[model samples]
Target: MSHSSSDDEDTDISESEISEYEDKKYGELRNGVQNVKTSNENGTFICPYCPRKRKQDYLYKELLQHASGVGQSSSKKRKARDKANHLALVKYLEKDLMDVDVPAKDSKPTDESDPSVNSHEQFVWPWIGIVVNIPTRRTVDGRCFGESGSRLRDEYRSRGFNPVRVNGLWNHRGHSGTALVEFSKDWQGLQNALEFERAYELDHHGKKDWFANSEQKSGLYGWVARADDYKMNNIYGEHLQTMGDVQTISELIEEEARRQDKLVSNLTNIIEVKNQHLKEIEMRCHETTHKMDLVMMEKDKLVEAYNAATKKIQSTAMDMLKKISIDHEKLKLELESQKNELELRKIELENREAHNESERNRLEQEIRENAMKNTSLHMATLEHKKADENVMKLAEDQRRQKEQLHAKILHLQKQLDMKQELELEIQRLKGSLNVLKYMENDDDGADVLKKVDSLQKDLRDKEESLEDLGELNQTLITKERLSNDELQEARQALINGVKKLSSLGNIRLKRMGELDTRPFFEAIKKRHKQKEVEDRVLEMCSLWEEHLTNPDWHPFKVIMAEGKEKEIIDDDDEKLKKLKKEWGEGPYKAVVQALLEINEYNPSGRYVTTIVWNYKEGRRATLKEGVQLLLNQWKKMKKVSS
Candidate 1:
């Protein structure tokens, strides 16, 4: 239902009139609703007076329609519920009316009655009064109110409405507060107030101790109202006046002229002061410029002097560097020559050692062979002596046995001859007995038998004696052969002993003829001593090189402290002292001193290669070159000392 402009105006007037009439009629409704206990259920409409507890889940507009009997039955039961619901609705409406400050009913509706009045005049200035319930009771400073007002003002301003004024009031407890904000003439204040009220209700619902019971609200609550002259005066002070009280144009013009006269007079005075100040600044600037010119001239002179001094220093440094480089090269060459000689000496030593080792092995082999030959000779001599003793014993036994055999042979020969004669006599007696056999028979036969028996016995004795003689002869011959063999063995053993002795004598002669190595050993000892000296010299040269090349090397100065020289343990220190004494403290002395200091301070030489040479600055010598230079310096020192 869109209305024409006139109709809209009429409707607005009617709505305003009704609202005013209702506010006046139910001025005590807010108090009535304060005693009514409403349900806290959000978005739910219920009739407190109805016996049947019926709740309608509806929006506020729909709930209003339902309570007003729209689309509802007209039955007696329905009518009774409707009547009870209407009574509850009336209280809520009254509470809503009390939230806003409506115009009095007796006030004239000028814009609605007189159409000749401007439409803008019909619009109301939207003034909102908000109640912010603070959570604490602490003392509120003025800043708190100021911050709150500023926020509210900013909010209105952001919405394209210029807030005329924003004011705040704090309660004694500082636990609650109120803010009154007035915006430029518009009905938007009403909507803003309504939204604030809803937010306040939602934020504080079910929160304990948020409000003075549920009758009072918490958080932010706002209501719209017109700002009258008294309210405006209270908010903006007495400096603000209504449009009707504005001065006439003639009076305004006269006042503006007077203000302009004062402003022009003040501007003229400011101009005069500014001109005077400018003149003083100009004079100071002139003096500062003049001083700056003098300073520049002095700076030029100083720069020229500095450049000349730098050039002189650079030339001197270059010449010193060149001299050092030359010395370094010479030293390097000398060191190289010495190194080559040392290498040659080392090779010679190795060769001599090899020769000595071979000679020692040969001597040891000869000694071993001689010892073996001597051992064999000793064994042969023992064998020879044993053989000779055996031979002598055999000869003595042979002689004794020969004598015994001769005696036994003679005795046997005598017994054999006697037996032969007895046999002859028995034969003769047997012949006579045979002739007289007949005459003397028995006696004679017995005598003959006896004689024959004695002869047989004697023949057996002779045979036994002959057998003994033959056996003795065979034994004597065997003994003589054994003695002869033993004698030959002794002779052969003696011959072998003689040969061993001859060979041993030759070995001894050869040992005596071996070359003497005493002079070779002495030469080796001398070479070792020379090597030690070379090593020391090499070390000194290296130290001197480091001193020349390394910037971090700080030379030790031989200071006469307490009227005596400090004792240093460094070998370089001794060498440096000698050099300085001989040279009488020149560049050589400085170099020596630096070398000594480096050796004394950093024995490990860990920072030897850390120095970086800058080519742009000058021709800096390399480590090798510097080392050569140091060697030359050392050689000169040695020569001078010698």
Candidate 2:
């Protein structure tokens, strides 16, 4: 039923059939959006009524889409106020962004007499403020301008504006509502004064951070525009002329400077436009040169055709002379015909020369025009070089501003990410809280309590090991990057082992293993390139690497043969059978080096194998046990020697 009502409401509010209130609302929004778009360099917009997370940082188009959707939505949950805001947004988007056919209002002409453009004098720099729709200044004997400037100053000063002088105007009988205020020369005072431009009366009363929203309902509302007091200069000059005022001297000089600055700015704009036109003229000159080349090619073709025609006419004349010699009576008539043809040819040649003369005159004119354009282009290029320095200065300023904005955005993004992470953690804690409540209310609460108690006892009993584990964790954290790399390497090795269909972990053989040479013999049967012992070792290692599958084969007995260390089969009397039985039929092999270490200071010396095998399983205590065993044997030997 709610959905049906929402749909009905959506159908009822046709876009073209909005009421007076909505039309006024939409008009105000359109104006606001236009002003904002003019001022805003970045095309980022946001829904004003949305929650903080959803409201910030939307591109212009995305905001438009959102506005369109929410304005015309059939959702039952949308509030009437929210719908009004979104509809205003839709109106702004369509009229200002989509249609884009509306003409802008005419801007006021530049006021050359405004003193702020060039004045740098202390306490005399001009800054104007306009206040409108204010209540009349009331006195004991009714409305009057008795110290009205002081009252206005105190009133505005309480609300973040600090105007130095305020002139409250009056009607014929009483003080009026209009006041012209003067502000300080500093930029901050101007900024504070400008902030009052769009503020209504109620906005000044309480809404300190309010926007110029037309929907705000208030009685006797006032708004103002910040404007330059150009006529103030003329008023001062007139006062100086009549009343012997000394302030007009500096004021006139400042006004003249402002006028000069405006003139220079206009001249610079004209020069920039002239430079653009010169470049266009240069392009036209290039096009004219191309056309001249085509005309020359046409002239060359015409000259060739004329030469061919001349040869034909000469041959015809030769033939006619021969005919004249053959018949005397016919000769006269043929001669007249030949003379008529020559006259026609001469007239055609004269017409061609006249056309050539006209063409040459036109080409010469174009050449002169092109030369003039080249001179103008050179002058424009020199002027453009001057403009480039100013443009470069502006570009540098914009670049610095862009970098500041980028840093601010990065800081904001980091804060946003941190806020999101904290929110997620809070949600997780809430979920944990719910789980704890469920556990407390569960029917198996007693069993859970017992399990907790048993776990606590176990924790206490294993406190020392827990401390050791924590130390190890701290070690890993200290060298986290290196530890992570070593872990990944181990994981990759295990994956490689699995891919070869071998043991995932190194398996310890009960006895030392020997090379099962039967497969090796079969493999190297067709090979007979064993020249040096080095060659034999290379061939053996290659064969071992290529054919070996399991990774547990760490055969490392290497000895000197033919001036190179060579692997040999150790077939000692007691271990031969055991070596043959252990790794005889394994599908794995490897070639590695091993050596024995003997301690010279020991009472009873024994050689220990120094073999390095990659072990993934964490059985580290075994190394300590082996060392302890060695120490005990050394002590026994020492006791016997004593």
Candidate 3:
């Protein structure tokens, strides 16, 4: 029924506008992501909603809250409110974590009837309090913050922090500002609260006693978690039956165990995942290292190409700028030339206007002279000729002359108008030229700006690439360090294993087991030169010992006719010094001389046995010398007979 209702609700709320909202949200997210991407383009600003920005926000929230007021809850109501908020936050987090589109079910409600009565109670008892002394002195000697415990208490209270104080002042009447603190009950709660509040700064007087130093700063510090246990026992009379039922404790223990197991499992999983991630990181490091080699090669090539490109671009830009400068200079020169031409044209036009005015004055003077002479002559002729004929001819002639003058005036006016129009056209052309020059300058400026933009963009791209490479290098270094540590550990382990194996081999060798001489000889032969002296020594010893052991291996020998033992001896300063140092000049010297004489011989004839004996052997024996002594002594001695 719940599922059907949920489906119905979902159907009712399935609106198309929600999809648009989602799309808009997605677009915003994409835009944010894009902003976070290394902005190679110049003048681009990062969006405020970037992941990096979000991370900073999150960090500020977490750290600031931890550093400030959220940690200062004391009253029950405040604590409960805080816990509820915490629970709501936890639920929000869980909801985000789960992402399951389902509503949670409500569990059964417990009793809501009475406020005072306990449904089940084992016992009731009055709150007991204990007063403990915490001195303001250091016990090592007498150094402290120079404050009495009471003064410290007052300071704490003034600071709006409450601290438990002992009744009356500790250490009797000498101490002032002592306070008595009252407690309702004794438990871990009071201790926790006290410890939390005890660390603040305090203002007081007097030095601490250093002679009775304790681990705690208060020289005579002591505390107990509970002081009511003995009283409860006394009241209960040794063995009163508890009424709360054992199941409660059992359930608590079980719940605690389950929680612990879950914690352990989670921790183990976390460790395993972390280890796996470490391994993956190692593998990635290897891959990256390999790729880095290739990347380095490619990077080198790219750097070469980029450098070459940059060099070319720089050369080109310099060339372009040089051309632009030249062009600008040329444009300025052209503008100056145009200004000079315009000035010259204006001067020429002024001169032309002055000449035209002078010509007009000359023409006016000729016309005035002609009119005066004609007027005088016309009056004299008017009286002399036939009046009708003369008057008609004179009128006709006057009309024709007036018409000609009018035509000349009209022609001059048209010439003046044409000159004005020509001047106006010249001015328009000059203005057009100026406009063209400005447009050319604007084009040049725009081109230079574009080049600057391009350069800036390239620089930004290179910088971003460099930063990425740097971050990658750092990550690589971290991975390399981890690998190197692991490898070093492994190498040490291998070395230890080798040492153990060598130790085992030494133990085996020390057990007096026979060695395979054939293999030993083969190894020596293969590894050492045939003419090596050690090989010759071994061969000679083996041959001599074999020959001496065989009963049938007797050889001819010569001796001093009446042979008593005769030993040859030689000495040098070194031997004398050694003998002098090793033994005192007494009977010990004679024994040493005899031994030295025996050791210093080279025998010529031999059919010998050798016997080595300790000096403690009581037999009257002659210690022979040289190879002959060695063989003869050995021949004379038997293992059982000796």
Candidate 4:
């Protein structure tokens, strides 16, 4: 429930409660009490709430409101307002200067017309009236004026004149008063007063007559004049000049007054014009300052924008550089990969080139051998031809011999020529055989021997390679056993990991079985009833919770408060237990538990056992339906009782 505004009037209440209590405390005190105090005996002095001395703050506020009302006629009301302000200022200054004292000194000839002159021209306006509070009565020796007004009047009298009116201390009790005095008709009187008072001391009886003292104990104490121009009329025609020159003096005085009035008017106009110029200057200064501020703000914004753009550009450049670096790295890796591939290709090419070179060398040797064999065969053919030619020559020689035998007488002569031809033919056949032997030995035979030696070395190298392969196979067989053992251990570890996971799952299942219960759903049903179903569900839940938490309290007690035990017919204990068990194995056990905890219990009908026994065992037949049915009956009873 919210508090009323009246509460705020109680000062004991905090600020936050003020809003609630605003309306009740309209014009009342903070204590919620109305004021009954009346005004003063004189209506002009009436100050309500005066008995409460702590009303200074409120009084100031009321004074401000009063001043606002008198604004249009401010010149007329100004005197009253000034009185009030002066009274306040006097009181404040009195308090501030409680221990302070003014010392006395003689006056000095200091020009009051000079604005910047540091003479008696500067009086603390707020504290001026305090000097009037001084005690100066009982006609102190050598005094020409009475009490408080004496100090002011005598100072002016020294200047050969009197003030229109002056503030004074009338009695020894420091009572404030004012007095009017007349000045001489001649200007000399006024001039003398103006000059001499510039050097007169405050205390008429006891003091040096100079105004040059710096400390409070040795300084002139008279305040400067405060009378307005119109008041000066009161000081005329009473002293100094005679009645015979009155007319002429009046004329001259009038003319001089007119001239002073004209000068004042011109000064007023000039001041007005200057004031207007000052206002314009101030306005221009403000506008220039505002424009400069705007320009500076714009410059700052531009700088920020430039910085943001530069940052974005830098970020983009960094991103591009990153991309380029990645691409460069990728290209470098690809180049390295290609280079390695080329190197492998070159090695493969070199292997192929070496194989080709070996094949070419073998082919070249075969071609050389074939050439040598051909040369030998050609030489043999030449030798054979030579032998055939010899054989022919021999046959021819035989024929010649036979012919010679037939012509025995001619043979002796031809024998020498035949021998020479046969010898030439034999020499040619021998040369041919020697050339064939030289060709076989130098070409075919040497190449066959070199090839045989190379064949033998290659056969030895092949046998060594086969032996090395056999040892490598043995080493591979040993490594295979170690690898198989490692594989078997890894498989065993994987199986163990699987078993642990299965065990953890089984443990989790068992723990869930212990935690889940039936009360969970009752809470869920209660919330659903509040939101969308019916409020009866919540009522039922409340009743159920009472029965569940307080095992000793039964629903029958709440429903049958008149001790009507016979009306209690419902019981669902076994069903409740079955529901509880079902909740344990369900995946939503936490949610169900939360629900049941929220809505603990609600009775509906009779025990299932009672109904079954009545129907199956042929027992007494009176039985309620279930928890819900019992709830309906109890509700009906409640309505009837109501």
* lDDT leader: 2
TM-score of each: 0.15, 0.18, 0.15, 0.19
- Give each model's clash number: 5, 0, 19, 34
Candidate closer to the true structure by lDDT (higher is better), 2 or 3 = 2
140 in model 1: Cα distance from truth in Å? 44
**Number of the top TM-score candidate:** 4
lDDT digits (tens) for residues 285-317 of candidate 1: 566556656765775686578657756865675
List residue ranges in candidate 1 displaced over 4 A: 1-251, 311-642
Tens-digit per-residue lDDT, 1-642, candidate 2: 011123444343433444443555566665553232423456666565464454565666677778768876878777554566577666666444532121123422224355533233222224455554555556777755533667878877887777766766555556655566666433444455545544443356322322356465433232222112222443322222221112232464455568568878999998789667656655665665566567657756865786577568656755765564455435445555655655565455445533577886865665566556555655655565566556556656755775686567556555544444344334343333333333553589887566556555554545544454456456658799787788656544533333343233442111112333444443344344545544554566455434222334323356999999865544442333342454342212222111111111111222221221235452222333333444565687799999
Evaluated at residue 387, the lDDT of candidate 4 is 65
Given candidate 3, what's the lDDT at residue 581? 55
Question: Where does candidate 3 stray beyond 4 Å?
Answer: 1-187, 190-254, 295-642
- Distance from true location, Cα of 484 in model 3, Å: 48
**Predicted candidate 4 versus true structure: per-residue lDDT over 1-642, tens digit per residue:** 111344532334343443333323322322325332234432221122233445433333353344333322336434443233233322222222221121112322224454533332322211121122233344445343435555666766565554433443233233333332333223433343334334433354122322245444432333222322122332221111111122222343455568668878999998789667656655665665566567657756865786577568556755765675566557556555654655565455445533577786865665566566556655655665576567557656755665556455234323432343334333333333333333344447876456555545554554555455457456678899899898656544443333333232111111111223334445445446546434544454454334344534342312555676343312344534453455333423333342333233122221111111133433322223222333555687799999
State the TM-score for model 2: 0.18
Q: Write down the lDDT of every candidate, Cα atoms only.
A: 0.45, 0.48, 0.39, 0.40
Residues 178-230 of candidate 3: C-alpha lDDT, one tens digit per residue: 22332222222233333322332121111222213545444222222122222
> For model 3, how big is the CA root-mean-square deviation?
48.5
